[model samples]
Target: MAWYATPGGLSSLSAPQLAAARRSYDLWSSGNPGLASKYSFDSYVEYAQQRHAESVAETAEQEED
Candidate 1:
């Protein structure tokens, strides 16, 4: 029912979606620090890193099971 619940949606993401998202955000910020400053850079980076770590952990747990 939910978009993300769909098989296609789940399959659309690569194995390392969080890494990809982090890289994209980093690139954007590097190119436009002023625009990035419009956001809370420290909080954004912290959240991104936390989410990436969680994703990696979850993937590892899934593989173990």
Candidate 2:
């Protein structure tokens, strides 16, 4: 299953929360507007949280299986 489809992954984020996260990422990226550099601090943090949540959900599913 996709990361977003995983248990606890989709439910972990509400519609408003997802919109806010997207807005934050967009704002951060737009501020720099350089391809040479990577994501900003806020973007990195958001990505890390998303990755961590997905990983945790995947691990839980694996353990269940």
Candidate 3:
């Protein structure tokens, strides 16, 4: 099934929109945006947290080997 967002939110995106979204995510994630952009502050934080957790879990698994 196709992905979706909120009713009045970004439920869908075009090619350019997807590219811009990716660029926006990459930019805000590098500690440069400083949580200033209201568009993706929370999402970016959640993405970073998920990445951190995955990295931590991977490291733990590696150390156990």
Candidate 4:
């Protein structure tokens, strides 16, 4: 699956947010101008939240060991 967002919209994101998005979605790393743009800020937030939760869970599991 691919994720897409407008260049204008992507441009509005903070550097950290853009970095995170690129990290999350490998396809975005290619520097493609605009192809099948589908994501919005909300979607990015959700993705970030999920990653946070997973990280928290991993930490908790590690602590239990």
The candidate that achieves the highest TM-score relative to the unseen native structure: 2
- Clashes per candidate (backbone, < 3 Å): 0, 0, 0, 2
Q: What stretches of model 4 exceed 4 Å from their correct place?
A: 1-36
lDDT of 1 by residue, 1-65 (tens): 22222233224445575455457668978998997888554455555555666777899999999
What is the lDDT of every predicted structure here?
0.57, 0.58, 0.52, 0.54
Q: Show model 2 residue runs off by greater than 4 Å.
A: 1-36
Which pairs of residues collide in model 3?
A: none
| Highest-lDDT candidate | 2
Q: Which of the predicted structures, 1 or 4, would earn the higher lDDT when compared with the native?
A: 1
Tens-place lDDT digits, model 2, residues 1-65: 33233234334666765666566566766776783166654444456577877888899999999
What does candidate 3's lDDT look like per residue over 1-65, in tens digits?
11112111233445565555567677765756565455474465345445666777899999999
TM of each candidate vs. truth = 0.43, 0.44, 0.42, 0.43
Q: How accurate is candidate 4 locally (lDDT)?
A: 0.54
Lowest lDDT sum, 10 consecutive residues, model 1, at 1-10
Off by over 4 Å in 3: 1-39
What are the per-model C-alpha RMSD values against the true structure? 11.0, 8.0, 10.9, 8.9
